[model samples]
Target: MIKFFRKIRQKLLSENKFSKYLIYAIGEIILVMIGILLALQVNNWNEYRKQGQKEIVNLKAIKNDLQHDLNTEFIPGISYYSKKNKDLSRLRDFYLNKEIIPRDSLLKYFRNNWGEWHIILNKGAFENLKSTGIDIISNDSLRTKISSLYSNGYPEIENRVNIVKQFYDNEFGPILYDNIILYDSTHSHDDFDDLKNRKQIGNRIIQHYYLRTWLFERSELVKSKVELLIGDIDKEIERLDK
Candidate 1:
């Protein structure tokens, strides 16, 4: 093509056709400009596609991280077992010694304490997501759903925590502390025998308690949310793969 254009120009120059050569030269300049513009457009398109694909990769990573967090932090099945173990040990000591519920207020105090602990753990997980910029992206539906879940869900948790805290402040701490001090100083009567007698009842009550049930339910809820997040990530990955 270069040789073909050069031959035409050489022929025009040999003939001394200055007007025709000047016209051809102007046309050639316009063609070169058009070719350059086309090349630039192609490059810009490629860059845009690359950036879009990179965004998808980052989104997938964030989704996977969210799923792992949900599984590790929110799933309370393992934690439930651990708490039960410690509670069982504490109950055993109380019962084996026939130690009466040193003060009627101890169980009440524990009930509130357990509730607050669950709320605090849940709140921490929710806040972690919020601490990142997970909520600000305008177009991702799944991300928005997860963000809304944390935002809306958190107020309920906060309210529950407040109730638990109020109960602890008003009722449990003073009563339990006073009795714990007296019992420690006095070497109180053997209460384990009494505890053993009521072991079955205590176990049943623990299972039915609101704190345990609430934690278990919310744990499952978060697990489901995490699974949905994973599913969304899978879709995005497949899209990018294509």
Candidate 2:
């Protein structure tokens, strides 16, 4: 092609037709520019396609993390706390009414009532997205929601769980350890509720119960948000597939 264009240029110049040669030279320049533009366009298209595939992979990774969380952490944790909260409520009510229940029942509640709420979120995919660039997600609304869930939602729930755990460990745990005569989960221990700080213990149990209740609700909230995000990611992946 280069040789062909050079031959044409030489012929045009040899013919002494300066005007025609000028026109030919201009046309050749235009052709070269067009070829450069087309090559650039193709390169850009390939890059775009590569980024699109990467986005889909990231989305799938995030979805997997969310699913694993629901299966292993969120669902089980929520159920555990839910049931534990109920037990705490009953124990609280029993304490309040000063009703003397069975020794085993009282000992059991005293032994296991102080529950801890802890949350650990899977942030691998999210961190990868952040390193690349959040805008890589493509969908404006989906990107925003993803960012909110990772940056704000997960952290907020984690912080709340920590606070609840701290309340249990620092306040309720000490009281039970000091006052309860013999508290054991597996072994049968002598149960006598004749503790010196009965009133203080009851109040602490009540306070811890409320905090655990709130923690349960917070865990449920985060789980629901994660479910919705998983659904959104599925929809986005479907759209991308086409």
Model 2 ranges off by over 4 Å: 17-20, 98-104, 112-117, 181-197
- What TM-score should be assigned to candidate 1? 0.51
Please report how far candidate 1 places residue 167 from its true position, in Å: 4.5
Those runs of model 1 whose alpha carbons end farther than 4 Å from true positions after fitting are 1-7, 13-34, 77-140, 154-219
| Candidate 1, run of 10 with poorest lDDT | 179-188
TM-score of each: 0.51, 0.84
